[model samples]
Target: MISEREILVLIPAFNEEGRVGEVIRGVRKFLGQSAILVIDDGSSDRTAHVSREEGAIVVSHPFNLGVGTALQTGYKYAVQEGFKYVIQLDADGQHPPEFLPAFTSKLKETEADLIVGSRFLTGSEERMSAIRRTGNKLFARILSFLINEKLTDPTSGYRALKSTVLQFCVQDQYAFDYPDADFLLTIHRSGFRIEEIPFRVDPRLGGTSQHSGLAPLFYSIKMMISLFVIMLRKKSADSN
Candidate 1:
């Protein structure tokens, strides 16, 4: 049984000063005193200050690191603090805190090392742009094939991780930039069980997504290359 003391809600924020406070408050409403930590990735804005005002423990970087690094920081904190489970929520309000209980229940029931909140799983319609949707589907299919599992939303950021998998996340084996499909593949290769739960994702409450305009295209291409590289590295390791 996971106690409230053993769980940590980690929110990674970068220039999300307008939305991070709301996200923190929403989580607090449901989580109720469970440790909430905000990783402020060197936001030039007031993200760290707003998060602190909302009563979350804030860890600010000296400069803007990528999302992957910020998330790894949260994982390292969780491990060091002896948290049994870590729930990762985006600072953007796309990931609603209302559905957090579902993640916890699914993780406990399935004993999954990680549980991803997938917007497509429950027929939850979203208003994503065509280019973004195309990139998402293409990458999801690629990752599903590589992992030999049907992953509906490989790019979904809202996820929960057991302590064992959290340990893996902080290690050097994890990805450095975006923790999308490539990171999921790394987790699978490391022998961790990953599952998906149906989730409803709202459009960002405020602030634009990092992957806007040409960014999604670049991100997709980078992730694809990263995925293949990971596959080759794993194969080579297994042969030795």
Candidate 2:
């Protein structure tokens, strides 16, 4: 199994002050504080302060740059800090830190470049709204076909990845906004091995979700366009 020291836990937050702390503590409890980095994407609230108080390494953005950019910042930090692997979870408490160990174990077992946390694989979609569930299925089918591999939940934010994938993500061409199905497809098309595992998600501890409201509809359209663009790109290289 991979040691905790080799792993960096990344949480991207925007106005998630009240809930990010709990997620950080849960990770520290399980991982012994090897490295817990929170990227505060220009949150007007006290996200950075609370994260610091909870003993996390905070990297704040000047303005809200969306979760994808925030995630890239964390990836760059992990690379510079010499972490071998990165485990990212949401700051809103939806992603449980209890499943983190499974990711490391899967890494050791399969050595996959990316390990995606999936709700459909374990039938943990009960927490997702009807619209989200439908969108997930539709995108999953499209991505699976595009990659010629099965994917249950391509939109899941919870995931673990190796340094190789991290290096890929830091490139200028990477998505800076919503990194969902298109992001996964980009990784897969770039020849990174992708795997999925079952993980349970809980409701947010506080605040509304970024995915709520008309955001999902907008995301769906944006993803559709992004996926098409990805398909038009070059094919995969040799798999690692």
RMSD of each: 2.3, 1.3
| Stretches of candidate 1 exceeding 4 Å from the true structure | 235-240
User: Which whole-number lDDT from 0 to 100 does residue 174 have in model 1?
Assistant: 69
Quote model 1's TM-score.
0.95
All candidates: TM-score: 0.95, 0.96
C-alpha lDDT score of every prediction, in listed order:
0.85, 0.90
lDDT of 1: 0.85
Minimum summed lDDT over a 10-residue window in model 1 is located at 231-240
Count of backbone collisions in candidate 2: 0
Tens-place lDDT per residue, model 1, 22-77, is: 99989988888589999999999999999999999999999988899999999999
Q: Across residues 1-240, which tens digit of lDDT does each residue of candidate 2 receive?
A: 678899999999999988998999999877884799999999999999999999999999999998999999999999899998999999999999999888888989995799999999878898899999999999999999998999999989999999899888877878648778999998988889999999998888989877777888888889999999888988766533
